[model samples]
Every structure is written in structure tokens, then in C-alpha cells.
Target chain A: DAMVIQNPRYQVTQFGKPVTLSCSQTLNHNVMYWYQQKSSQAPKLLFHYYDKDFNNEADTPDNFQSRRPNTSFCFLDIRSPGLGDAAMYLCATSTRESMSTDTQYFGPGTRLTVL
Target chain B: AQSVAQPEDQVNVAEGNPLTVKCTYSVSGNPYLFWYVQYPNRGLQFLLKYITGDNLVKGSYGFEAEFNKSQTSFHLKKPSALVSDSALYFCARGIKAAGNKLTFGGGTRVLVKP
Candidate 1:
């Protein structure tokens, strides 16, 4: 079935170390988004890619970066992991042309633990 | 800007009883409302959405939501709550013309006791 998939459901990284979380989709949607969800909080949008164009949220930290190397794959790279950065990272996809009723499909999410 | 609000942090309901989760939204243009359910350690699953037309929209898992234009609310409802229905519920809003970015509510955890 067509669905979004994320690698390394749980990840552990040392403080200040670089880590990458991967997301791939079989749905072939035109838009891909990355969100950070802390415990007991709503998922916050970090960045998204409408095709090759990257759109970053205004409040997203500089340490967070993302790349959409191709239509099906997107990667979130943390330049320097911090304790506060430990949270569930979610990846979602949607077909933008269906803008009015577009529904985002999500992956299981990668849980990052910064030590 | 588009935003969604789930007033209750948690809701407790008895099995087989009716349940309602409150949601209010703010949007510049016509609102596209949606409801998603998340189980523990799992991704969010879409339950339903209201794009336009009817005020009542039925969706997966015997769930439904009523859209009130005047109240700026879209509350999730179920006739008979089930124990398996317990999970975190989220309300989200998106602008008609703002691409596909969604603004989600803080989420309300629902507990259905048997």
C-alpha cells in the first residue's frame, strides 16, 4: 500500500553530535513536511518542501535543516543535537494540487533521544 | 493565520455512552477542518474532514463531526463510545488558499472506560 515510512523508529545521539532522520513515501505526493512533536504538545511544523522549494517555519531553529533530494525522499538533519531536541520527529505528505481538501498522511515517526 | 483549539486537555467517557470532543477554529478564509486520531507510539490517522457543503461529515471508525459556521466550531462526535476508541484526538485547520500547511490543536486525550 502507498504510505509514508521513516527510518530508525528510535534514535540515540550524543549532545552536539550530528544526526539525520530519513523519510520516504510511496504515495508520490508533491509536498513533504517535517514536524517536531514533544511529549504532551502539538506537533510543530519545522519545514516542508513543495517539490524542490523548501519552506521553513519562522520559529524553527538554525540547528534544524532539511533536504528533499528527490520526489520520494526527504531528510531532516540536526547540525548539533541538544537535550531539548529529543522528541518525536514526524514526516507527512500531501498532494498540493488538491489544496482545498488535501489530507496529510503521516509516518510512524522517529523518536530521537539526545544524550 | 489559521489556528485550531481543543479546549479540553482530556475527556473521560464511559463505554457505550455518547462522546463529544470540542474544537474551535480561527481562519482568514473559508476553513478546512479535520480530525485525526493517534494511538500510543503511533502516527496520526485521519478520521474525517469538512471542506465544504454539508455541516455533518461522517468518517472512518464510525466517527462524525459537525461543522458550525456561526460558532466557528467543528466538534467530533460518536453515538456509542468504545474502549478501543481511546486515544489522543487532534483538531486541525487549513486555509482554503494557503497550500496544504495545517495548524493543529494541542490535542485532547480521550479515555473510554469499560
Candidate 2:
């Protein structure tokens, strides 16, 4: 099936260490997004890539960065992992159009644990 | 600020009974609303959306939602709830100016007792 896929369903990293989560999509969607979802909280948008243009959320922390090396692959890099950064990282893809409602498809998500 | 709100933190329903999940939104201009479901340890699955046209929109898994512009509400509904329907439900609104970014609600956990 054409779907979004995430690697390392569970990840463990030491505090202040760098970690990377990966995502890929077979849907060929033009837009890819990364979101941070804490336990019992709504998934918050961290950043997104519309083609090669990166759009970061205004309130996203500096420690969080993302790269879309290509259309099918995107990576989320945590410069320095913190306890607060331990959360489920979700990757989503969507086919965007001018002035249209686009439905985003999501991956299973990576559960990050900062020790 | 554009936002979506799920009033209830959790909803309990008996199997085979009607299920209703409430959602309200505060956004500028015409609202584009959506409903998504998330199972434990999994990503969210798109259920339904209302951009324009009919007030009632039917979606995956026998689920439907009614969009009320006057009430600024889009509530998800199911005629007969199933045990498998238990999960976290979220309400979201699309922000056109923000590259059609989705602003999601806090989410409501649905519990359908068999």
C-alpha cells in the first residue's frame, strides 16, 4: 500500500545527545510534516516541507530541526535531546493544491525516550 | 488565533449505542474542519472532513460528521458504536494562509464498552 513509514518505532537516547528519526512516503505527496505528540496531548506541528521549502513553526524550539533530502524521505534531528523532548514523533504526507482542502496521511510514529 | 477545541476529555458509550464526539472551532474566514482517529501506539487515521457543500459528510468505517456553521461546531457521529471504535479522536481545522496547516484539538478519548 502507498503509505507513510517511520523508522525505529521506539528510540532511546541519552540527555544532550543527538538523535535522528526518519520517515518516508510512497504516496508521492508534495508536502511532508513533522509533529511532536506528548502523552495525553495533541500532536503539535514542529515543521514541514512543502517540496524543498522548509516551514518551521514559530514556537518550535531551536533544538528541533528537520531536513527533506528528497520528496520520499524526511528526517527529524534533535540537536540535544532533553527529557521534555521525549515524545512520539509523527510524520505525515499530503498532496497540496492551490486553495484546496488536503487530507494528510500519517505514519505509525517514533516513540522517543530520553534517558 | 485559529484553533480547534474538543470539549470533552473522554466519552464513554455502550456498544451498539449511538456515539457522538463534540468539537468546536474558532477560525477566521470559511472553516475547513476534519475528524481523525488514533489508536494506541499508532498514528492518526483520517476519518472525515468538511470543506464546503453538504452539512453532513460520511467517511471511513461507517462514521459521519455534521458541520454546523452557525454553531461553529463539527461533531462526529455513528449510528452503532463498536468496541473497536474505542480510541482517541481529534478535531482539526485547516489554516489556508499557513500553507493549509492543520491546527488540532486536545483530543477526546472514546471508550466503547462491549
Candidate 3:
């Protein structure tokens, strides 16, 4: 099935260490997004790429960065991992046609644990 | 400020009983609405959406949602609850002015007792 996939479902990293989370999609959607979801809270948008044009959320921290090397692959880079940053990171994809109405498909998510 | 609201933190329902998850949004213009379901340790799965036309929208896994313009609400419904249906549900909205992002509700956990 054409779906989104994330690597290393669970990740463990030390404080201040840099870690990368990967996401790839078979759906070939034009838009890819990264979101941080804390415990018992709604998933917060971090950044997204609309066909190589990166759009970052205003409130997103500097430690968080993302890169879409190609249409099928996107990576989230944590420059400095913090205990508070340990949460499920989700990647989603959608089409560019009508952003307000298009449905986003999501991956299983990568759960990051800070040590 | 634009926001999506899911009033209930959790909803408990007996198996075979009807289930309802309430959601309300405050936004400008006509916004697109969506419902997503998340199982434990999994990403959200799209359930349904409301763009225009039908007020009542049916979706996967026997789920349906009603869009009420006056109330600014889109509530999800299931005629018969199942034990397997227990999960976290989130309501989201996409406003054209907000760019390419969906503002999600706080989420509502549903527990269907068998």
C-alpha cells in the first residue's frame, strides 16, 4: 500500500546530542510535514516542505530543523536534544492542491527518548 | 485566535451503544474540518472530513460526523460502539488564511466497554 513510513520507531539519545528522525512516503504527495506531539497534548506543527520550499512554524524552536532531500524522503534534525523534547515525532504528507481540503496521511511516528 | 476545541477529555460508552465525540471550532471564513483517530503507539489515521455540500459525512471504520454551521461544531458519531473502537480522537480545522496547516483540538479519549 502507498503509505508513509518512519524509521526507528523508538529512539534514545543523550542530552545535547544531535539526533535525526527519518520519514519516507510512497504516496508521492507534494507536501511533507513534521510535528511534535507531547504527552496528553495535541500534535504541534514544527515544519513542512511544499515541494522543496520549507515553511517553519513561528513557534518552532531553533533546535528543531528539517530537510526534504527529495519528494519521497524527509528528515527531522534535533540539533540539541533536551529532556523536554522527548516525544513522538510524526511525519505527514498531503497534496498541494487545495491545502485547506486535502487529507494528510501520517506515518506511525518516531518516539524519541532523551537520556 | 483561531482554534479547534474538543470539549471532552474522555468519553465512556458501553458496547453496542451509540457514541458521540463533540468538537467545536472558532475560525474566520468557511473552514475545512476533519476527524482523526489514533491508536496506542500509532500515528493518527484520517477518519473523515467536511469541505462543503453534505452536512453529514461518513468515513472509514463505521464513523460519521455532522457539520453544523450555526453551532460551529463538527461532532463524530458511531451508531454502535465496539471494543475495538476505543482510541484517541482529534478534531482539526484548516482555514485558508492559515496557510497549509491544520489546527488540531486537544483530543478526546474514547473508552468502549465490552
TM-score of chain B of 3: 0.94
The residue-by-residue lDDT of candidate 3 on A39-65, one tens digit each, is 957999998999889988899999999
User: Model 2, residue A14: displacement in angstroms?
Assistant: 0.7
Please list all clashing residue pairs in model 3, or write none if there are none: none
Q: What lDDT tens digits, residue by residue, belong to model 2 across residues A1-115?
A: 9999999999999999999999999999999999999995899999999999999999999999999999999999999999999999999999887443899999999999999
User: Sort by TM-score, best first: what order?
Assistant: 3, 2, 1
Q: Model 1, range B1-114, lDDT digits (tens) per residue?
A: 437899999999999999999999884677899999999887889999999899999999999999999999999999999999999999998755444778899999999999
Query: What digit string (tens of lDDT, one per residue) describes model 3 on residues B1-114?
Result: 647899999999999999999999885766689999999999999999999998999999999999998999999999999999999999998867434688899999999998
The TM-scores of all predictions, comma-separated, are: 0.96, 0.97, 0.97
Task: Rate residue B68 of model 1 by lDDT.
Answer: 95
Of 1 and 3, the candidate ranking higher by DockQ: 3
State the local distance difference test value for candidate 2: 0.93
**How many residue pairs clash per model?**
0, 0, 0
Scored by CA lDDT, what does every candidate get? 0.92, 0.93, 0.93
Weakest lDDT window of 10 consecutive positions for candidate 1 chain B:
B93-102
Q: Model 3, B98: alpha-carbon shift in Å?
A: 6.8
lDDT of 2 at B106: 90
What is the Å distance of residue B47 in model 3 from its true position?
Answer: 0.3
Model 2 clashing residue pairs (backbone): none
